[model samples]
Target: MSVTPITTANLLARQLKNLINSGSLKDGDRLIERDLASQFSVSRIPMREAIRQLEQEGLVKVYRNRGAVVKTLDASDIDEIYQLRALLEGEAIFQSMNYMDTETMARAELVHRLLGSASEPTQQGLYNREFHELLYRRCKNHRLLEMINGLREQIERYELFQRRLLSDTLKFQDEHEQILIACQHNNPAAARENTVSHILSAGEILKSYLLSR
Candidate 1:
């Protein structure tokens, strides 16, 4: 078994991604190579490489004079992302219904249970991803799944805020249950509808929250 080594740049990129997703590094915040290198006890080379990685991931934007700034999305961006998510994930779940079996559903149920029990926003978000991925992975459309995951990554920073709200969490859980039930009953239309509705509802809530702030 060959294990890939984790390079310094890769490690720094993952840490920076966590910081951004957790909102520790807010939108529009500048990523200074010298400052970050000193803060992380790394050399400037790896820090620069790390910022480049994030730039490719759409989390950081590089300007000629301003260096790299954390990417910020407006309400319209949020709405558009969720719209795409609904379309892609709805199709994914609809297609995956043909492949969903007892074992997969059982795993999804377990993930849902874990999500309910998760106390921290980050942990809950992870389980939420797990649950959704388990359902969508069986779609057998690799490119479709890739696009869905990419869009999910784009909105994760905003999702951190939504996860922190108990009301929002409760609503999402209920929707998750609806989706799971639809799957178990072999109702693909209902599953897709529930998934679309869930994404749109969450998008609206997040957009409102951001606008109010």
Candidate 2:
């Protein structure tokens, strides 16, 4: 297997994204460039590039003089993002149905099993992402996949929040199973419907939790 090259900027970006998703970097917290560079042992250049990438992903907002602050999400932000996710992910899964092979289906099943065994919400979330990515990897539209990934990253923090309160990983697993079953049966329309329902249900649950906070 060929190894994918990892860049300094991408590495820094992943670390920063982890901080945000884990809530170590709180919402609206200012990111000091020099401090982060020192912490990560990188120069200002790659740090800035990572910040720019996060900003593009809606995780950070850079100001003229104030520098970068973590973007705070309200209930409305959660609603809008998930709504977009429902639409984009649903369509992507539908398109991928024709292209999905047996190998990908097996991989997805493996990830789903791992998700069931993952005790930590963060680990579960990662496995969940892998499961969906496997299902959607065959999507022919590169741009749509890119957008879906961006949205997924943007909403990961919210997913972490939801997982803290909701212990219904089994329900999510069941939904994932339904989607997989649709794929196994070669039912694209059923797969699309299940995916959209799963996303929208997650959105509603997250929205209610966010509003209650």
Candidate 3:
């Protein structure tokens, strides 16, 4: 299999994406080409390309004369995304549970352990994604998986904010364990319910934070 080449633009895009997801780059922050290029020791061309890539991912918006600014989601956007995620991911996990094996369960448990131990918000986010992806990996519906991933990406910034600003990480991890237990017991219905509950709970916390700000 041929590997995709990583260019300067791709590297820059990944860095910018991480910054955005980690809450270092706040919503509506401008992507100043000159400043970012100097900071990253790159040319303006790649910086422009990087911002364009983030724009494509719905993380950045570009206006005619204003360059790119980080995209901010409103309360409605949060509600819609989380509602869709609850439905789609709930279904995905239910379907995947039908095909779950010992190995997948074991791997998921490992990821969950890692997630609980992860101190940094970014590291916790990564392991959390891995744990959920592992649980859903056995689902045969590739399109469904793609949709779930897309929705998760859209709300990731909010998730990072929730982790950093709220005291709910431990509560969330407890919910994760509950989901894992349901999956391990081969109870698809309970797993689905737990998964949906976990997502909606996180969404509510985020929405409350956003509105209070």
Candidate 4:
């Protein structure tokens, strides 16, 4: 992959996120200092910052001696995410429809192709985020977008845990298509309803994987 133009911490997050999504950094895998530092070709300082960022995102747990291990998310986190998404995403989409129009719709239509061609899971995941954010930006509500951004980050990272849960992953792709369709049709209610089902389904899927792990 071409080196992305990103901040040191963001670059670290992307690499570690890639590790998790690719199954190299398996769930609950403890981060080894020397190994990761060597692999990333960076100093320990940036590596530590990345770990701290992951911990903030609920992707890693920073223990006393263990350094950092990926968190085994419990049911409560899933529930909260879905609950929050249902509460917020609907309004965000409704507000967005007024701001997003034909040109943005054309661009959104092409984004799916980019996501489909992504070679790796993390790339696909980031594209997935960019896809939704493009639509979300139409809302023109900064605070709402900020809140939803955090929610999306948590949702995406947790969903990454379902690497072998192919069924749910496929379901998400279908849901993404549905979201795009709703946006194209300019139906906010349909878009909102679809998003709620999508997020709630995600919570259920995540719960099964979390419990099994």
Candidate that would win on lDDT: 1
Q: Candidate 4 clashing pairs?
A: none
Query: Could you tell which candidate, 1 or 3, scores higher by lDDT?
Result: 1
Rank all candidate structures by their lDDT, best first, as comma-separated numbers: 1, 2, 3, 4
Candidate 1 residue spans exceeding 4 A from truth? 1-7, 113-123, 166-169
- Which model scores highest in TM-score? 1
Query: Candidates' TM-scores?
Result: 0.85, 0.83, 0.80, 0.69
Report residue 162 deviation for candidate 4 (angstroms). Answer: 6.9
Residue 13 shift from truth in candidate 1, angstroms: 1.4
Predicted structure 1: lDDT: 0.90
lDDT of 3 by residue, 1-213 (tens): 999999999999999988987789999999899999999998899999999988887789899998889998889988998999999989999999989999989999998888777788767777878888999999999999998987877777777676563234488889999999999899999999999999899888888988988
Residue 204's C-alpha lDDT in candidate 2? 86
Backbone atom clashes (below 3 Å) for every candidate: 0, 0, 0, 0
List clashing residue pairs in candidate 1.
none
Ranking of all candidate structures by their TM-score, best first: 1, 2, 3, 4
- Each model's lDDT comes to 0.90, 0.89, 0.88, 0.75
lDDT digits (tens) for residues 6-72 of candidate 1: 9999999999999998789999999999999999998999999999998887789999998999998
Give per-residue CA lDDT, model 4, range 134-205, as digits (tens). 777788778888787777666555555543343335676788789889998889888888877876786787
